[model samples]
Target: MAKNKLEISYEIDFELVAINASVKEYKLAWMLNKSLAWNLVKRENIELDFTGNKALLISNYLYETEYQTFRLIRNRAVDGEEQFNAFIIPELKNFDYFIMLENESVGFDLNAFISKIKEIPFVQFAVLMDAAALKSKDNLIF
Candidate 1:
């Protein structure tokens, strides 16, 4: 039996209340990337944030199996972009599924999302899956 590889991305925009409320795009991207690190093996939640102000990414395969590995590196913006290029590079030789979700409380277009995302050469499969629903599926087995 072969395992399925899935990668989900999400971003929550909270009203930053600070004297300056300064947030670099890299930090926000790193935070969302942190959300994707789900490990059933370690039974642990590790949030690894990058150390930079620019849009930088570190693609790490924390959970790997013979069939597949979940690789996700994200940089979030109002739109599906960043000044610096953020890539989700899979470092394995296997047929896999890639799921990308961008749920902003503001601007997002379904047609545009699918068209551009599917066009990416490296992406074998890509689409938006609801974050809440995915969380439920992660817990329940049928």
Candidate 2:
């Protein structure tokens, strides 16, 4: 008798940009909206619960069009009790925020977008990141 095997794989079909800026999350989102003409609106906070009752509340801003979706998320979550910072992607803690773009069309240019983001006065720098290379990339699915 022969047995069938099944394997599951997830495809990360989005573009990730790591942004390093000293401004607040809402201010950064507003800057992006003003600079790029993107209508990123404030959305409900994303809550992630971990073991030992650890929880993280991350701020997210979203902009959606017919062909694409954009999310600007803050990277660090401040702990009220301990006065510490917890990062979304622990390996990339240096980045203050992350911008995720999910495009259903092929016309979107990531390099050009990054360049434009770098031009913003509030943005210190922005760089494209490979999602598949991160160990905690699964945290981005939300």
lDDT of each: 0.32, 0.87
Residue lDDT tens for model 2, 1-142? 9999986456898989999999998899888989989999999888877777787788899999989999999899844673245788999988999999997468777788899999988788899999999988878887
Best by lDDT: 2
> Mind giving the per-residue lDDT tens digits that candidate 1 earns over 1-142?
9999998644421111001113433342243244433341221222323347543333222334444333332222122243344222222112132232322334545556445544444344444544333332321110
Candidate 2 has an lDDT of: 0.87
Task: After superposing candidate 2 on the true structure, give the runs of residues whose Cα lies further than 4 Å from its correct spot.
Answer: 1-9, 78-84
Task: Report per-prediction Cα RMSD to one decimal.
Answer: 17.6, 3.8
Candidate number with greatest TM-score: 2
